[model samples]
Target: MPEIAPLLGETLTSPTAFHAPLHAPHEEDQWWRSSVIYQVYPRSFRDSNGDGTGDLPGITGELARLAELSIDAVWLSPFYTSPQRDGGYDVADYCDVDPRFGTLDDFDALVGRADELGIRVIVDLVPNHCSSDHALFQSALAAPAGSPERAMFIFRDGRGEDGSIPPNNWQSHFGGPAWTRTAAADGAPGQWYLHLFDSSQPDFDWDNPAVRAEFERVLRFWLDRGVGGFRVDVAHALIKAEGLPDWGGRADGGSTEGFPGWEAPMFGQDEVHAIYRRWRAILAEYDGERILCAEASIDPLPRLTDWVRADEMHQAFNFAYLHHPWNAHALRDVISSSLTAFDAVAAPTTWVLSNHDVVRHTSRFGLTDGTPRGGDGIGHGDPQPDLHTGLARARAASLAMFALPGGIYLYQGEELGLPDHTSMPDDARQDPTFARTGGERIGRDGCRVPLPWRADQPSSGFGGADSTAAPWLPQPEGWAGFARDVQAADPDSTLSLYRTALQLRRDLRLGAGSLSWSRPFEQSDVVAFLNGEVLVVLNMGEFAAPLPPGTVIAASTPGAVEDGLLVPDACVWILSTAG
Candidate 1:
């Protein structure tokens, strides 16, 4: 690690960049090679300015909190300039920080401070699409139809006389056609562009060298600004199939819900590999081991690992656990298939239970529908995970994640056992699921509501020191039991569970090996596996299960694993082979 020269300025670099894996001859402390990254959804982290929305400074304010749990890196989701059509996934500018978040200097300070604390910064990099209001989009709109600036996007000629048109049958991620008629006031009115999510976000034309160059510029813009790596968004979708062929006969209600027709020809196509290689080359110029984590969610591990090979991304998220049903046998199946494939390909992978885009884990499992589930709340008793069973479940799940073969990402509020704040009242919705479909999807707002820092106050502890801004989204009543301050002080709190789980991940080399499930604990609802030294057994159910031999190494239930059986409702047993 670089020694800090408090008086120096120009020679300064993010601590992680200077550390650069050179100190450890074999790059041993190159922790991220296999480690846990704590994901912070900025808006809910802390409100230093008391504006109800979290800012970079708020995140900086919480570094000590994270350090206490021993995380390797922090992957911040888009703090760049954006119209936020998809919650900041659409970029308007690559070089500047959004004022709503904080200043560039604030970011630099955050990076420097984190490096000072030995933490790395892996920022979200949105390259596939740009906001409709982006500068280039504006330039393209004002130019001639065939201008090179206009070629930066996929502007197609008008359709046949009937006008049934698109570059392909691909569907947008948010639902709808992937193509939109380009309506540049000064340019051709009949031209079209492809947008895989909101029509406002036009996909870049990878076939255009200039487009690729601009994205490379975007990548360097941050690495130069002190970012350690990137969380490549929609990485697999960065490039579409060459001819934009349709998935013949695989029908569906639309392309968004994975009914199949559009996913194949449009998502994680083999062609995206070239784009990753292109980006990695630019990253290497900054530092040889520059990390790039792909966000591909497709199956058939080889297809996904295509972007995570030795020369490609250092890691690509393995979303099997997130997409699987919350059951023991089901989880075991996905783990077996995924581990086998990922190991065979020699590509590193990662696991994340919750993220800014997914329904909060609590809600995903039907535990949160604005109903009473336990803990200390107004009408409810305590807002915490007060039940013996719920705590066991949460602990087991977290422990299992830590014992996996690669890095694990911890969602912002998972450490506190916070549930999706679904009871925030109707008119206070902040998610597009409700805006776009009139609540057909019930929106992700429930998971995105205000984060509670305390349980003693009306806001459950997350307002200003003088605190009051109505929060960007309403605070869910479920937070009554999971406030940060309350959990921090409680030895038996979920925060404690998280701290223990994360500590174990860092102290053990569980993140660097291969995971292979053994004997298949099918009937027990346990996803059992081996992560190097320890035998990890996860009971997806509330009841306990039998363990093979070794002494219990680390069980989620503080005391759940006694003789051989685990208590029901999420219990984990980490046993040594000797037992």
Candidate 2:
């Protein structure tokens, strides 16, 4: 390891230093282009009512913490009325908050508070599906096959002579058959409904004008409530292929593949663009720079950019970049491809390290090098990660992400370098994937454990000290070391690293700009790139590398630089005044 040194002094010691506005803010309407949005999974963020579940009020209470982190916005995961079948993604009502999360008034308060703190609010919009218990789905079950109610969802007659077979061989993204047969009003078996995800989340028929108009109303309802934008869940899946053709392959559902079946007949269809175009028009009707961001995993890479056309979504999460191994060459390849592709469509590329659906990057990076995708396969019994090495790379990766052009997303607890609670008990798992896969896959529950706010407080300060309720998901025993309070006090903690990186991201004017790779280093594992005047150098190899010729402005790891040497699994920002 290289010798560590303090790069900045008193500025970092003060809490208010991070809140200072950027030296130059981007254009108002183009805020989404280079914004740093933080994603908060409501169930695990904080519990205000002592119900062991997080709520809107809990998120509202943390606005100051977010504002202090220097993030531009917060993208909250679903808090909509649901049956808890797939977290909150299985929306029972689009316009209402789940009673478990809080009331509509609480949501309104959260939005208001976030706005006051200069942090925009972006709610998750699960437009592709709704809970089976939704009034519309219930009505569709009671109504006849040809009834208009049934037309709202993708309902079709079974194929066999006795109509005993599923409508098609399509499999659920979670696991098992995608089609579920419903009993008719008279109690006889009826048509089958398609659900690409969990059975409780029945897929909507986007071709249906009613479905289109209903979501339009949903968007307006939130927009009227002052939400700045939306994160479109499964954005590439709103429009399936017209004929609902078979994928002509095994029923593995591509669940095991790197692309996660994104190119199948059931996802990423060309018609999806039309739906977004209509949504863009509705968003235009609202003021205050409302935007749409797609959670797309579309393949060929460029297809993800299609959802971000000028009149459609403003940004789409770069899953390709997220899935890349911690290799300098691989990271550079994806970054170049994403920038070129999105630039061609005049859309900003959004970079993300971790989210609710995937294993936390800290844990993911800890594993030995391999092509691992999705969050289902690894868990408590899996091989433990090299936490020391993983965290170093995670910090380095975050700096690299912030140095890139366009927007970025920070998942909750990632700032603390929280790893997946890989030892979580199987009985404690609640993800639909776990139940559906019969414990064959562990699911994403490990990463959803409640965050640690204070080291010694009950529920790790996730809930108030007097509150007796346990966290919905148990915190790992090692969480105390990563507690927000602890990290806040320690200047060298990952939490502090994120604070410094985010502050420097704006102070250096790194977000809104074009990017170009600097000349190669002696080591192939070293990646150096220029974001305006800031030369970002990242060493992913095991040995030290020489830093570019410039003044070191920021470093991801504490000992990232010594005697002009860049240490392994580290990143540094250099101010190239002579360039």
Candidate 3:
């Protein structure tokens, strides 16, 4: 381990350092273009009522902590009414809060508190599907074939004799056939409905005008309640090809190879653009320049940029950059391609590493073999990660991400350098993917563990000091070391690193600046870029490298720079002292 050292002396020691006023602020209308938004998985954030599950009141209480981090907005995952068969993604009531999370009043309080802190709130909008228990879906089940209620969803006659087989070879994202056969009054096989994800989540028939009009009302309902925007869930899969054609590719959803040259009939259809244009116009009618962000995963890289046209979404998640290997050349290629692609559509690219869905980047970077193992759950039998090495690379990667000229999304607990609970017991897994795949694929439960707040408190202070049940997910025994209270006291802790980096990012307006590669290190393992007067260098090689010409400002890892040499798996920020 590198010897820890004080970073900024007295400035870091002061409690108010993170609360310092921003040196430059952009207009409110264009905030999404260069903002740092934090994503909160509500169930795992904090349990205020001591029910093991986090609620809106808990998130409301943490607005001050987010404000101190200089976050421009908070993007909350779904907390709407649901049976939770698919972790709340299967929404039964789009306009109401689930009792497991809190009442509608609690949501209003959270939005109100966030506004006072100058942080906007963005809620997840799962438009592509809803829970089978949803009122409309339930009514459709009872109605006869071809009824108007049944038209709201993708219900069709199966292809086999007695209508037994699925409509097509489409496979659910979880596993198994995408079409589920419904039962008639006498329990005979009836019409089949399409659900690209879990069977509990039936896809809406966007072709229906009623579905389109209903979503318009849903958008306005939240916009009127003061949410700054919506993160469109499965944005690309909302529109299927004409005639609901059969997929000629693999059953597991065709490979991403030959992406721009070939397109998937099930996803990223051209018709999807029209829907976003209409939604964008709806957002324009609201005050405060509301925005829309697509969670689309289109491939061939550049084709993903189509979702962010000027009249469409304000931004789209850059999955290409997130999934790139931890190689210098690979990272550079993705970064260059992302900036170029989004620039063509006049949209600012969004950068993200970890979220509730995938393995935390700390663990992902730690794998020596670099096998893609954690997209599903990482079980006890799986190869373990070297967390020590992972933390070093994760810190370095974060610095590189912040130096880019676009918006940033930070997953909860990443600032404390938390890794996925790779060894989580198999029986404790809750993701539907696990049950659907019958243990063949372990699920996303490892990354969804509750966060640690205080080192000494029960459940790592996630449930507060009050009496209650255990956390929804069991926290690792070593989590006490990564607690917020523990890291806040150590000047060299990852928490301090994030606090200092975010503060500098806001003060320098780095997000609004342009990026240019450092010519000398361009062909080497060093990723060195100049963002205006600031120079950011990330050394991904095994050997030490000489420092670029500048005055050192901040380093990602303590002791990253020694005798003017930067060690491997580290990053540093330097300011041009010579004009």
TM per candidate:
0.85, 0.93, 0.94
Write candidate 1's Cα lDDT for 1-579 as tens digits: 222112221211222212122111122556666767888777767777877777899889889888888888898988888877667777898788988899999999999999888888999988788889899987886766799888998776646773447656766655556788865465535677788778889888877889888878878878987788999887777766777776543322223444542357667666678878777777878863568998876655556667777667888887766766667777766666665566655654577777777655554455423343211111122232233444455566777777776668888888877666645565766554455555444546656666787777656756655776767777755666788888888876778877876677667666765454444353445566555456666656544465554566566656766544555555454544411
lDDT (Cα, 0-100) at 471 in candidate 3: 88
The candidate that achieves the highest TM-score relative to the unseen native structure: 3
Clash pairs, model 2 backbone: 380-422
What lDDT would candidate 1 get against the real structure? 0.67
Give RMSD to native, each candidate.
11.0, 5.8, 5.8
Give candidate 3's root-mean-square deviation (CA, Å): 5.8
Q: Top model by lDDT, which number?
A: 3
Worst 10 residues of 2 by lDDT: 13-22
**Alpha-carbon shift of residue 80 in model 1 (angstroms):** 1.0
Error of 2 at 372 (Å): 1.8
lDDT by residue (298-363, candidate 3, tens digit) is 777788889998899999999888887788889878888888788877788899999888889999
Query: Residue 231 error for model 2, in Å?
Result: 0.7
- For each candidate in the order shown, give its overall lDDT on alpha carbons: 0.67, 0.82, 0.85
Q: Write down the worst ten-residue block by lDDT for model 1.
A: 16-25
Off by over 4 Å in 3: 1-29, 250-262, 577-579
